[model samples]
Target: MSRALRAPMPDLFLGLISGTSADGIDAAIVRFEDGAGRLRADLRLGRTYPWPEDLRTQLVALGQQAAPLTLDDLGELDSRIAEGFAQAANRVLAEAGLTAADIAAIGSHGQTLRHRPQGRHGDGRHGFTLQLGDPSRIAERTGIRTVADFRRRDVAAGGHGAPLLPALHAALLHAPGEDRAVLNLGGIANLTLLPADGAAVRGFDTGPANGLMDAWCLRHTGQPFDRGGALASSGRIDPTLLARLRAAPWFALPPPKSSGRDQFHLDWVETALTGHEAPADVQATLLALSATTIADALRATQPSTVRLIACGGGVHNPALMAAVADALPGIAVVSSAAHGLDPDHVEAMGFAWLARQTVLGLPGNLPSVTGAAGPRVLGGIYPA
Candidate 1:
C-alpha cells in the first residue's frame, strides 16, 4: 500500500463528520505538507452528502429525544451510518480523481448519538459520549486506514471530552498580540478563546446554535434549516422566552464544560415556552438566545477576548451573524474565511489534522481545553 501511494507521496487524508445538527455528512480531503516547522493543511476537495431521508429522520428523532436504543437497534444504526460515511468517502475520492489506495487515511468523527460531558451512573461520576458508526466498517469499506472515536480518551482522563478544536485553532489561527475566539456554531455553539498574551487556551460549549433553529424551521416550514435565518428574521424575538431559555443551569457553568443536541432539544426548549407563542417567534428567540449566549461567553473569558471568528453552518445565516455582531458591539465577529480556511470545511479539516497527529503518535488532546488530566494522543485506528 505504501509503495502504491508513495509514487505521489499521498499526503491526502479524508475527514468525515455529521455534526450535531444530524443533517448530513461532510467529507473533506485535506493535504498536509510541511509549512515552516509545522504541517499545514490545504483542503483540496470537500462535499457534503446529505443523509438519506429515512436516516436523517431517524437521526433527528434520536437527537431530539436522546432516547435509549436497545443494543440490537444501536448496532444496526451504527453499521448503517458507517456505510453512509464509507459511500461519502468513495464519492469524494471519485470527484477528486483519486482512489482509496491513493489516500493516507480517514479521520471519521462518526455521528454523535449522545454526548454527556458529565453525568452520573450507579458506578461513579462518569463522563460518557457516544459517536455511532463503526470505524472497522469504515476501514473495511473504504479500503483505507480509519482513525476515529476521538473523544472518549479525554473523558477517561476526567475531562469534558469536547470542544476539541482549540488546539487546531491555536495552530492555524492564533497570532501574537491579537487575542481571538473561535466560535463554532454547529448544532450547538462552542467558543474557544485564543489569548494573544500566550496564556492557556480556554473554551466551552456556549449552547444551541443551528440545531434548535434548524429543528424549528423544519417543523414549521418543512425545510431542513432556516435559510439565511429568514424565518427568524421575519419574526420578532420574545425577550421573556429568551430570558427563560438562558436561565438554563448549563449556561452558568464555568469553562471545561460542554453541551449537545442531546441536552438541548425541542422538548428542552418547550420547558421554557409559555405555550402561547408563535413558532417563528420561538425561532427568533432561539436565534437571539444563541447570539447572546455566545457573546456572553466571549465577554466572560478570563483574559478578555478581542475578536470572534465564526464558522460552521450557522455562519451562512446572515441574520444570525448580524445578531451576534450586534450583541458584541466592539468585537469584530467575522467569518473564518478571512483566516485562510473556509467556514464549511474548518471542522472537517480539524479532524483530518487530528488523523495526521494520531498517525504520527503526537498528542491530539489538549489538557487546557478539554480539562483532561494531561495531554494524550486521541483516536482509535482501524487498518484497511
Candidate 2:
C-alpha cells in the first residue's frame, strides 16, 4: 500500500511518546513527505495529557533517591503506562479531526525504565535500556499499526540508544546559513547541534534538567515540580557544591552518550551537598549544575555562532533559562517556538516523525549521533 501511494511521499504520520520525566504522554500528528536528507512536515496537531496522579507519583518516586523500586513494581508500572499512552493517542487523534484510520502508523517510544548502554565490561556487560509502553496494546487500542521499543537495538549495536531525536532535530531546525543547537530540557537535558549546512548532527544527554530539580522540590516543598524555577531562583548558588556536581564523571564523558535517573538522582544531588547546605541553596546549585553542564556540552562542539532553540519543560523555567544564557555569552538562546515548533511538543513530535520513518522504511537513528553500527532502521512494529 505504501508502495502504491509512494509518489516520493505520503500524507501524514503520527508519533507518540512518554519521556523520562513521566509527567504525561504526548502525541503529535504530522504530515511529511521526504525532502533532501530530511522531511517537509506539517505539525497538524499535538496535545499532552497528564498521567494519573497515582501513576505519576509512583514513577517519580521510583526515579527518586529516597525510595527505590522493585522489579515487580517496575513491571506493573510499565503496564499502567501503556494504558495511559493509548488514551493519549486517542485524545490527539480526536483533537486533530482524525482517527486511527487517518494516520499512516503510530510511532510510540514507550516509557523508559533503565537506560544503560551495552557492554559495560568490568562494570559488567549489563548496559541495557528499557522503555515500557506495550506496542501491542497501543496498536490494539488505537486500532492503528504501532511502531515502538525504539532504543535497545542501538545499545545492542554498541551505541547509547538515546538522544534519538537528533535526526528530526536536524531535519526540522538546521538553519541553512548559520549553525544552530536544539536543547531539550525534559526530565534530562539533551542537545542536538546542527551545523550551518544541515549535514552533520551531534547530540547527547547533558546530565540532569527538571528530573533532579523536581525531585528536590518534592522532598523539600511537597510540590511535584518547582513552578517556573521560582524556588531555585530564590536561593543562592553554592559554588562549592556546584564544583562537586560538575566533577561528576558523566560530565566528562564524550558524546554518543546518554543518562537518566540512574546517573542523576536526588541521591547524587544530596551527595554533592553532603556537608550541610540549605535546601534552597541545594536547589540553586542543582539548577546551576544543569545549566553549566549543558553549556559546557554545547561549547565542546565548538560550533561558530550557536542559536540555541530551547524546548521541553525546562524552557519555561526562567531561572534555568537565565542561567543557560548567562553561561554561554556568545550563544543566542531562544525557544523552539521561534522555529514554529512548540517547546512542549518538540520531542513528542520527534517520535511522531520517527513513526513515519519506520513505515516509510527509513532509518530513524543517526549513526553519527547515537553511535549505532550504521543507519539501521529503528523500532518494532505491531499491527492492530
Candidate 3:
C-alpha cells in the first residue's frame, strides 16, 4: 500500500516493556501522525520506572534460569509483574499530566521469561516464547484498552517471535537510496536490515549485548553495569577467551534467530573462561565479543549497509560503540537520537506504535525478520 493512501490512525498510545535486562519498565507515550506520505511518531513522554527490588531479583533469576520456578511461583510472578507494569503506566501518565482517557491504548510487551524460537529439540514445531504481565490486569488498572502477547502468534506461525521492532525501524529510519541497518543494543543485540531497494526488512538477534556485560560487571564490580564501559576500558581483551566466546553454536545460525538471558547468562560466559583470566580482561573480552559478533553478522548478511543506526541501553556505553565502529570500518555508526528518537526509549516507543497497529488491525511482524509464515496482525486486545 502507498504511504499516502494509508488510513489515518489514533494519535496517542502508551507502550510498556521490561527488556531482558530486567532493568526497569520503559514507558512511552507517543503521538503518531501521517506526514509527507509517511507515518511519523512523536514521543511525547518517556520514562523508566524501577522495579521493586525483590521483584527485580526474581525476574533476573528467572530470566537467567538461575532459579527454578513452579507453576504457582510463575502465577505469582505474573501478577506482580502486571502490577509493576500498571504502576509504571500510571506513573508515566501522572508525570505527563494526562488521564487514562487521553491515551488511545497501551501496548505492553510483557517481561519475557523464556524465548525458545527453535524449541528445546531444535525443531520449529514445538517452539514457543513466553512473556509475563497480564494485559487483562493492565487494562483493568489503567482503565484503557491494552495489547499484549505480541510474539507467540508469530512463533506459532514458525517465526522467532522476536526482533519485532524492525518494522518500526524500517518505517521510521529507512532511507530510500541508502542501505542502512538499525542495531538495538539492549540485553541482547538485534539488527534490523533496511535495503535501499525497498525490499522487505530483515532482523534477528546478533548475540549478547549488555546482558552478559552487565551480569559480569555486577558479579565483579558490584555495579549493575559498567557505566560508560569504564571497567571494560580498564582492561585488555583476552584473545583466547574472546575466541572461545565467539565459538558458541548460536552464532552460526542464520537470520530470523532470537535469544535472551536464558541462553547467554553468566554461566554461559563462565563456560568459556579458563579461570586464569582477570575479571577486567573478561569484561573487555565480552565487550569485544558484542562488537565483533555484531560486525560479523552485518558483514556476512548485509555487507552493503552504509549506515548503522544504533539504539537501546548499550548505545550509552562508549567503549562498546567505539568497538563497533572500529570493527565495522566502512560503516557509519550513529545513534537513533540523531534521527529524532530517544536511544533508550525506542523499544518502548515501538510497543506504543505496535499497540496502535493492533487497534487498527494492521500487521506488525515482518516475515523476513522473524521467519513467520507471512505478515500477520500481532497481539490480543483487552478492552478498557
Identify the leading candidate in terms of TM-score.
3
The residue ranges of model 3 lying beyond 4 angstroms of the native Cα positions read: 1-10
Better of 1 and 2 by lDDT: 1
Model 3 over residues 120-218: C-alpha lDDT tens digits?
A: 777765898999998999999999899999999899888899989999998899999899999999999999999999988899999999999988888
Model 2 agreement with the true structure over 176-255: per-residue lDDT tens digits: 88888889999999988888875678888988988888888988999878898988988999998889889888788788
RMSD in Å for candidate 3, one decimal?
A: 3.6
Ranking the candidates on TM-score from highest down gives 3, 1, 2
Query: TM-scores, in order shown?
Result: 0.95, 0.93, 0.97
Against the reference, the lDDT scores of all candidates come to 0.88, 0.82, 0.93
What are the clashing pairs of model 2? Answer: 15-352
Candidate 3 lowest-lDDT run of ten: 3-12
State the lDDT of candidate 1 residue by residue for 161-268, as single tens digits. Answer: 898888888888787878888999899999888888878987788899999999989888999999988899899999999888889888998888888888889999
**How high a TM-score does candidate 1 get?**
0.95
User: Which residue pairs come into collision in candidate 3?
Assistant: none
Where in model 2 is the C-alpha error above 4 Å?
Answer: 1-10, 35-38, 65-74, 118-124, 197-199
Find the 10 residues in a row with the least total lDDT in model 1.
117-126
